[model samples]
Target: MHFHNNGNLFPLYLDIRYSFNAQSLVPFFAGAGGIMLDFSELDDTRIFINPSAGIRYVAANRTAMTFSTGLMVITGGPNARKSFINFKLGMELKRKSL
Candidate 1:
């Protein structure tokens, strides 16, 4: 994850995820803005609260793909009021191995 300010000072955040099996996954979320969480395999719920961009790569069963997402927070600055939400999705291959 990465964030940039008015002076182009980019602060980065990182998170590591590990899968134990097909039904169990654990993630250690971390960031530069003092954000952290330990997510378990309970209904596949993950949360992030930061103003930055991040990329996640998942590889399994000899296949790999990437997922990306971004976060933003709008503060009442002297310039204007900005509030928006964005989502992205990408697929590498779609087939059945039989």
Candidate 2:
């Protein structure tokens, strides 16, 4: 899944993620980002035009985890780029939802 200042980039996402088939599984990682091609309004569900990136992991039918990293260019707020890098680790039974 992807989102930007305009709205959700992709409503649904699916991928052939890789994983380690073991008692303690290894997850698959994925990431994506790009610059805005046009301008738009901002709201509660909108993110301003800025450099953005995100990472996600999925364990073989067991667990799924996701995290986002990015920089926000605020208007006269702070002449700084809001950056973040996070991670998520969780367990899944029948299906993954983390």
Candidate 3:
């Protein structure tokens, strides 16, 4: 998902993240994504780079929580190059053993 001056844009994005300290209580990760934002007026295609870093923690009950923050560089139509910060939080629950 992408946000810019016009509004929200649903573009195809690909990103990869690397994590450190897999067995630790708290893990750190960094990732970067590439996306193309289309401009109808300018009739051009622009590539936006989104980079972020985050931390993840797993509780005793096997519930995981993650918090990430990144910046999205959007290059829209003419004279429209902006940068916005994006923050995301996620949670995951694991199933108990039988």
Which number leads on TM-score? 3
Clashing residue pairs in candidate 2 are: none
By TM-score, the candidates rank as: 3, 2, 1
User: Can you write out model 1's per-residue Cα lDDT over 1-98, one digit (the tens) per residue?
Assistant: 22323212222335444333342222222222332122222222223334334343445544445444545433322224344465545444546869
Q: TM-scores for all candidates?
A: 0.28, 0.29, 0.66
Candidate 3's C-alpha runs over 4 A off are 1-8, 36-45, 60-62, 93-98
Q: Of the pair 1 and 3, which is ahead by TM-score?
A: 3
For model 2, residues 1-98, the per-residue Cα lDDT tens digits are 44544354322222233334434333344433333222232222222333433444555565655444444432211223444444434444464457
Error of 3 at 91 (Å): 1.6
Off by over 4 Å in 2: 1-17, 20-24, 32-44, 47-81, 95-98
> For candidate 3, lDDT tens digit of each residue in 1-98?
54545744556667787777766356565655555545443344555777888888875577888889998786745557778899989897888899
The model with the greater TM-score, 2 or 3, is: 3
User: Candidate 3 at 12: error in angstroms?
Assistant: 0.8
Q: How does candidate 1 score on lDDT? A: 0.36
Best by lDDT: 3
**Clash count in backbone of candidate 1:** 0
Error of 1 at 75 (Å): 6.4
Task: Show model 1 residue runs off by greater than 4 Å.
Answer: 1-7, 16-48, 51-60, 68-70, 74-83, 88-98
